[model samples]
Target chain A: MLRLQSVRKHYDTFDLDCSLEVKPGMITGFIGANGAGKSTTFKAILNLIRIDGGEITVFGKPHTQITAKDREMIGVVLSDSGFSGYLTVNDVAAVMRQMYPLFDRADFMERCRQFGIPEKKKIKEFSTGMRAKLKLIAAMSHGARLLVLDEPTSGLDVAAREELLALLQDYLEEQEERSVLISSHISGDLEKFCDDIYMISDGKTILHEETGVLLDEYGILKVDETQYHALDQTYFKWRRKESFGYSVLTDQRSFYLENYPDVVTEKSGIDDILLMAIKGERL
Target chain B: MRGMLVKDFRLLLMQKQFFVVIVAVSVFMIASGQNTSFIVTYCTAMGMFFSVSSIAYDEFENGYAFLFTLPVSRRGYVAEKYLFGILCTGITWLLSVVCCGIYEQIVRPASDPAEQVLITAISGLVLFVPLAVMIPFRLKFGADRGRIVMMIVTALLFGLIFLVAKAADSFPVLKQAVRAVNGLSGPALSGVAFVFAVLAMGISAFVSIHIVEKKQF
Candidate 1:
C-alpha cells in the first residue's frame, strides 16, 4: 500500500536515504533511536517535507500527485501535533464530519466515550493519554485505507497502550486491504502488533525483516573474549564489546545454538536488534 | 473547502466574548453620538483581524503538521481563508451599517442617512484591500513575524503614498489626474474601488496559494 525507494532528504547535520514498504494486509513498524530519521522518513512519505531524491508511492501513485480525494484514503497521526488545542471534541467531530465523506462519527464518539475522553473539554485541557486517544480515534474514524502513525502510543500508560494497540488490531481486521506504518519508542508494542519491522539509523535503513523472523531467528550470543575469537564470525551481522565479553548479533541463531553450545544465546527482540544494528560493528 | 470554513468559523466562535465586546463598544459609541462611520470601519477591521488570526491559530503548537494531513490541499486552504475573510469582514460591515442605519432612523429622524451609509460602504470596500494584502504575508511569515512584516509594509505603503502626494503637488498634470479621479460620479468611483478590491484580493490569493504550496509542514 505504501513504498519509499531510497527516499532522500538532507539537513545541515543529518541526511536520510530510507526505503521501506508496507504491504496490503500488514502492519509495518519503524524502529530507530531518537534523531535516527524515523520522523523524517514518515514526513517524507507523507509529502510533508521535501525529499531531495527518490520516489514515494502510496496506493500506486506518487505521493506528490495524491489529491484531496486520494488523501481521503490515508489517515495520519503525528506525535507532537494535532488539531488546535482550543477546539473541543464536539468541534473536532463537527469538522471531521465535514472533512471526510465516510467519517464514522458515531463510532468515533463511542470510542471517545469508551476511552473516558470528555467531549466538552478543550483538547488542550485533555491529559496526554486522552489526547493520544483522540488523535488515534480521529485518524481511524474516517474509513481510511492506510494509517501513518508516528509515535501513536507515546505518552500512554501500559493499559492505554495495550488498548490502543488492540484497537489497531481491530482496525486491521475490519478491512483486509488496510495497512499501517507505525513508529514508536516502545519496541514491545511494535513486537506485538507489527507484521514486519524496519530498523533505521543515522538516516539510513539498516535492516528490514519480518517480525517473526526477528523474534525467532535473530539472537544475541554473549561470549568471553576467547570464545568470541574461537567461534565462526561468518554468521554475525554485527557485534558489540561488553564489559564481560563480546556480544555478537547473528541472524542464524540456530547455527550458534548448535555449533557453539557453550556461548550464551538469547532471543533478540526489536530493541535488542535495534541496539545491535545501530551501535554494533559489522563483521 | 466547506470543512475548512466550518473549522475557521468554529475557531472564530471560540472568541465569542470578543465579538460581544466589539458589538457592545460599537453600540455604545453610536448611542453616545460618536461618528456613525466609526462602527463600519472599526467592526470591519476587527472582523478582518479575527479572520487572519485563524491562520495563526492553525499554526499554533505545530498545528499545521496535523492540519495538512487531513484532506485539505494547500491551495484549497488558501482559497478558503480568502473566502472566510470576505464572509467574516462582510458580515461585520453589514452589521455595523445596519446598526448605524437603525440608530439614525430611531434617534435622528431628520438626518440624511444615505450620504453617511455611502461613505461607510466605501470604507468597507477599502478595508478589503488590507485584508487582501495581509493574508499572503501571514501565510509566508506566520503570525508573529507576519505582524512585524505587515508593520514595515504599512510604513512603506504610507511612505509611497506620501511621495505620490508630494509629486502630485509639484506636477500640474499629476494634480489634474487626481482631480479627474475625484471628479468621477459616486457610482463610478465606488465601482472603481470595488474592482480594485477584487483585483487586490485575487492577486493576494494567488500569491498565498503559491506560498503555502511551497511550504513544508
Candidate 2:
C-alpha cells in the first residue's frame, strides 16, 4: 500500500538512504534508535519535510498527486504531536470529527473512556501516557486504512500499552486491507504484533524480514574455548567470553549444531540482532 | 473547506482577545459617538490586525501541521485564511454601519441617506485590500519579523507620500496631474479604486498561496 523508492535525504551530520515497500494487511515494525532516521522517513512520506531525492507513493499514486480524499485513507501519529496544551480531549475529538469525514464520534469517546482519559481535562494537565492515548484515539477512530505511528506506545504504562495493542489487533482483525507502519525503540511491543520487522541504524536499513523467519534463521551459540577456536570466523557475529566458553551468533545454526552437539544454541531476539548489526558484526 | 473553516472558527472562539476586542469596539463606538464612516474605517483596521494575529496564533500553536494532515490542501488552506479575513472585515463593517444608522435615526429622526452610508462602507472595505495583501506575506515569514518589515515599509511609504505632496506643491506639472486625477468624483472614482484594490488583493492572495505551497512544514 506504500512504497518509498530509493529515498535519499542528506544533512550535515547524517544521511538517510533507504528503500522500503509495505504491503497491505501486514504490520511493518520500524525499529531504530533515536536519531536513526525513523522519524525522518515518516516525515518524508507525509511531506512534512521536503525530500532531497526519490519518490514516495501511496495507494498507487505519488504523494504529491494524491488529493485530499486520498489523505483521508491514511492516519498519522507523531511521537509527541497533537492538539495544543490548552485543548481538552473532547475538544480534539470535536475538531477531528469535523476534520475527517470517516471520524467515528462514538468510537472516539468510547476509546477515551476506555483509556481513562478525562474528556474535559486540559491536555497540558494530562499525564504523558494519557496524551499518547488521546492521539491514538484520534488516529484510530478515523477508520483509516493505513496507520503511520511514530512511538505511539512510548509514554504509556504497561496496562495502557497492552490495551492500545489490543485495540490495534481488534482493528486489524476487522479489516484485512488495513495496515500499520509503527516505529518504536521498544522491540517487545513490535514482537507482540508486528508481522515483519525492519531494523534501521546509522541512516540505513540493516535488515528487513519476517519476524518468524528471522527467529528461525539466526541462533546464539554458546561454545567452549576449544569449539570457539575451531569454529570458522565467517560463522560468528560476535563473541562474549565466559570463564569456560564464548557465546556467538550465527546464521547457519544447523551447521553449528551438527559440528558441535554439546555447544548450546538459543533463539536470537531483535535486540540481540540490533546490537550485533550496529557493531558491524552481522553473520 | 467547510471543515477547515469550522475548526478555525472554533479555535478562534477559544481566544479571549477576540471577544475582548468585540466588546471594546462596541463600547468605543458608544462612547465616541463617531460618524458612520469613521466607525467603518476603524473596524476595518481592527479586523486586519485580528486576522494577522490569528495567523500568528496558528503558527505558534503548531496548528498548521495538524491541519495539513487532514483532508485539506495547501491551496485550500491559504484560500480559507484570505476568505475568513474578508468575511470578518465584512461583518465588522456591516455591524458598524448598522449601529451608526440606528444612532443617527434616533438622533436626527428625519434624515434618510442610504446611498451615502453604502458608499462610505464600500470605501472602507476597499481600504482593507492593501492590508489583506501585506498580512499574508507577514505570516509566510516569521510573524515578529513580518511586523518589523511592515512597520519599515509603512514608514517609507508615508515618507514618500509626504515628499511627493511637497514636490507637487512646487511643481506645476505634478500639480496638474494631481488635479486631473482628483477631478473625477463620486461613485466613478470609488468604483475604479475598488476594482484596482480587488485586483491587487487577488494578485497578493495568489502569490501568498504559491509561497505557502512551496514551504516545508
Q: Evaluated with lDDT, which candidate comes out highest?
A: 1
lDDT of each: 0.92, 0.78
Chain A TM-score values for every predicted structure, listed in order: 0.98, 0.91
TM-score of chain A of 2: 0.91
| Candidate 1 wrongly placed segments (more than 4 Å) | B111-114
> What is the per-residue lDDT of model 1 for residues A1-283, given as tens digits with 9 covering 90 to 100?
9999999998999999999999998999999999999989988888889999999999999999989998888999999899999999999999999999999889999999999999999999999999999999899999899999999988999999999889989988999999999999999999999999999999999999999999999999999999988998888899898998888999999999999888899998889989988889977
Query: Please, what are the lDDT tens digits per residue for candidate 1 over residues B1-217?
Result: 8988999999999999999999889878877878888778999999999999999999999999888888989899999999999999999999889888888788889987877677888889999999999999999999999999999999999999999999999999999999998998766777888999999999999899889989997
Candidate 1, pairs of clashing residues:
none
Docking class of 1: high
Q: What is the TM-score of chain B alone in each candidate?
A: 0.95, 0.85
Residue lDDT tens for model 2, B74-115: 888888788777776767677777767787788877877676
What is the C-alpha local distance difference test score of candidate 1? Answer: 0.92
Model 2 CA lDDT for position B61: 49
What lDDT is reached at residue B64 by model 1? 91
